[model samples]
Target: MGQLMGFLNIERKNQKERSPLERVNDWNEYKEAMTEEGARKQAARCMDCGTPYCQVGVTLNRGTSGCPIHNLIPEWNDLVYRGLWKEAYERLAKTNNFPEFTSKACPAPCEGSCTAGFVSDPVSIKSIERAIIDRAFDEGWVVPKPPLRRTGKKVAVIGSGPAGLACADQLNKIGHQVTVFERSDRPGGLLMYGIPSMKIEKDVVDRRIRLLEEEGVTFKTGVDVGKDITAAELKKSFDAVVLCTGAVKHRELPIEGRDLQGIAPAMDYLTASNRHLLYNEPLESDLDACGKRVIVIGGGDTGEDCVATAIRQGCKSVVQFGKHGRLPDRRTEGNPWPEHPNVFSVDYAYEEAEELFGKDPREYYVETDKFTGDENGHVTGLTTGSFKKIEDGRAEQKKWDADLVLIAIGFRGAEDRLFGDFDIEKDPSGRVILADERSYQTSREGIFAAGDARRGATLIVWAIEEGRKAAASVDLYLDGKHSLLKS
Candidate 1:
């Protein structure tokens, strides 16, 4: 409550974004940072309600009501209001390990639940968060702080995505030696590869990875776990093993022509695109979207990334087929404040596509029937159908022009290779089965699973939460009841 009536006296000042026309021309972040003074005023708008639902950290109606990581929102907001930037950064770090990543990538359910947003605009929580963390780095406040002492324990964390990275970070802080294994050439799994550079430029991910290394977390890349290192070996070598392997098995559109030369999974296309951008790899037709007719299936983050990628590649046309019809502009009665509202808003990719193509690439209520290809066997076009209702099974079918197709529907579960080789029991959907009513441990003792691999594909913040929780569990398993980490 830096300013008791600050919310009433001062109108909200949101951070402005770079023009879409200018941003899409390169692979870089588009949003501009808000000023320190502006952030303080915005912080003054925090009402600091007794409940403070912006950090409620609960799930309802299949959506997040507030920040999943339970970020100390009001604390930092008040600190910023008092011009205590360093204090704000310290408060921010207490909850979130990577505000920079989340600020750029998260949908900000915290803002959705803001008291001010119930009437007018919400507190600029996301931008203010980004400002605090970015300034922390710029001021050299973010430096390596190796643990005070060693616990004489070792933990092997599989996968280098957010969950793995977060788990490694927590374990290291508690003085447990941690090593993260990644199959790819780079360390960050989704953060470095799955997400496009336009949303969060590569260097941001790299900066964090470098810091993690400096803090004593070992990163081993280009080493497949199940193949190069066996589960038996990990269990024998390390005191405990935490599996942070994300749910990466993509749900496929296995219709006819799926085997065509140009048809590939969303990850393959995205990974290839990311590799090209980060490593300067040669791009082939299937991997490149430049000047080709591009059609993306599924309308989630992956699909949006494909649309953004295609636009940046100078594709002839971009079309996204969303199985569900276009969402309402405003939240429906079913989606009240504090819950993640199911409403329509343009993302960075959508804005870029709109500016470049003169129309939004999304075709709602559309479903793919089958893909039709040219005589040469390379993908050329596909068939589609419309859905009158999301529950409706049938609609009018038609053919659409497409040279490249990216399927971004969603993930099924973890890949069969890594977990399956452990001889671990699996759920009906192939996810590693947990032990008992509440457990991160699997049928195999000393082995624990967290994040998407356990709960299926979820938000990034949720992944970080799972990692922290699992790391605590792993510490308990290692150091018994005397350990400081939460069980």
Candidate 2:
């Protein structure tokens, strides 16, 4: 609203990314930051629309329409446009615990639901958000602000992913002594390992982890809760326990030859690569794609990450298979405005694959039949059948050569065995049975579950929202009265 018809006067420009050919050679972040002026101009494009849908934060027709955490989009856009970088960051931090992570990795349902997008391009909300947070860090505005005093109550948060971290951060801010436990070597469960460095550099994840440590959140790495520490011991040690353990039980292709030597779960592949990159672990000792023909089964962010990781590892060739047909170039009639678009566009990994291999690596509408292995017990290739529709007759099966097959199909629920020691009820799908939707408390008293553990697999933003709500619920349960902590 700073400029009259700012939406009409300005054009949307995204941040520049490193050239695919060059970026594929290293594990550095791909996207570059936008100039301050460019970001301000982009913020000005947030038109003065009544009922800003960009922050509606609702789900319509099974698709998210806006920001899941309900960021104050217009307020910050105006602040950025007026060159109030600090104010913008303040407004952003009010709701989002980690703007840097979201701005870099979130799919940006906010932009998809922007009122401006009804006619013209949506405002560059993600870029402006990134600019504000990155500037805040550069100016040293983001620092540890521990609570004025301790509340004497202690909370134990299991897992160190976004949901767990957010839950721990909120509780710590409210004066509760919070301790986070991660089963992995690093504290950041998903951010540090699941996501490739090209999307979010390791330094960014480490910076936040260090800040949390400085703010009085204790992190215990390489500590498996069920095995290393018993449920009875944890209950006796902490006043309350919050399970933020994510849904990491990967779904497997139960078809024949699934046990082949070269086949591995997508998360294992990504985790191995990231560990090798950060900890200098021998890639060959785990799952290395070097000089191998890689095939990624299933599609989505995980599959894209596999493709990008393989490219970085100097794979001979890579291909991704999706059982569904290609999405339309434009939104279909059913997917209207305010809904996250279901249209097709090239993602970074696809673009990089095309640049290096001279062709897109996506093979849609293909269903894998079975794996074919050589006598040495190593995977050689796989057979896939093409389908025009879900019920249609499949075309003749075709064989594709692949030395390594990464299954990115998706996750089920949390690893049930981890919670077996505790007498907590879970749904048939393995999700913890919450006492109620209003309270994230699990079946047992003083125990709560959030994020993927309660909701199954979901976006990081939703996980953050779940964590905040769980924190508020926990605070109420602990105080036995109205809690000041915001959900």
Clashes of each: 0, 0
Query: Could you estimate the TM-score for every candidate?
Result: 0.96, 0.97
Cα-based lDDT for every prediction = 0.85, 0.88
Candidate 1, backbone clash total:
0
lDDT by residue for model 2 (409-467), tens: 98888777756777788876555444457788888899898888888887888888888
Q: Could you say which candidate leads in lDDT?
A: 2
* Clashing residue pairs, backbone N/CA/C < 3 A, model 1: none
Give the TM-score (vs. native) of candidate 1: 0.96
TM-score of 2: 0.97
Off by over 4 Å in 1: 389-394, 432-439, 482-487
